[model samples]
Target: MTLPFYLRGLLLLTLIGCGWLLWQDTSDDLDSAPTAVVARPTEPAAPPSPVAATASVVDLFPAQTWTPAPPPTPVDTSPPKPPPLPFTVSAQWRFENQSKIVVLHGNGNQYTLCNRCSIPGRIVPGKMLDAHYRLDKLTDTTVVLTYMPLKHASTLRLDTH
Candidate 1:
């Protein structure tokens, strides 16, 4: 499937970031100073101020403890699956126009050809068929029946064998 331009750009940026992170070094400079040597200062340091050894505590208790109610059960909001494909290759016959149309239909969908009357199967318009063909092959004479959702309209390919 063709990826959108934005998605392709995002993937490219991710790959570049990963490559940079993998090759970059993060070590600190050890030659600059040693911890023991740096601890010995040339000048004397000032004394720190005195602080309380322990903090005072105050007790304030609630008369009753209330438990929070559990969150409401999550509702299922997913969309229902589309109906199954209805058409099957009951028989393959060569039309007189020297073209072949694979007919498919579902319980509610109807299949129709450019020239022929609406067949018993699901009828998808031409544009939707084009989108399906973008990722699949339907030219083989061997009828492969499958469930397909008709979502749009376009010109059907009559020349496909």
Candidate 2:
């Protein structure tokens, strides 16, 4: 026969052969056997090593883990205080070459007394002036009066203002 006829016959035979194979019974194979198929595991087989020096959750978020130090302790930022205020002196005069008695003009009065004087005695102020206080330090311009029992002191100056 011709080459074209032979080629056409070959093509027709190939199509018929493929169609026959596809139409054949796969039911026989299904009834024959079923091979096993294994499933993969999702987790690791071993635990992590502690000595590996792995990065930690803290390391991942250093900013979250970090904390700022407390603010520095507050410094004392007030003036050296004027001496404790108990009483104030307006003027004072010491007897010539004598420390025993001093003449003080204050609180609109003249008081004559020794270094240590008690309440209702000197030119001291307040109803509590009965509380005794001693002259701890005295100058021409100022006087430091100290309560002997309490050890608390007040500075009195020449100018009440």
- The lDDT leader among the candidates is 2
TM-scores, each model vs. reference: 0.26, 0.27
Rate residue 40 of model 2 by lDDT.
92
lDDT of each: 0.45, 0.56
Instruction: Estimate, for each residue in 41-157, the C-alpha lDDT of model 2 and write its tens digit.
Output: 898688777756464534655555467888999999975553345444434445465443445554454554454454256543322333455556644456666665666677766
Q: For model 2, give the 10-residue run with minimal summed lDDT.
A: 122-131
- Range of the 10 consecutive residues with the lowest summed lDDT in candidate 1: 152-161
Best by TM-score: 2
Error of 1 at 24 (Å): 99
**lDDT for model 2:** 0.56
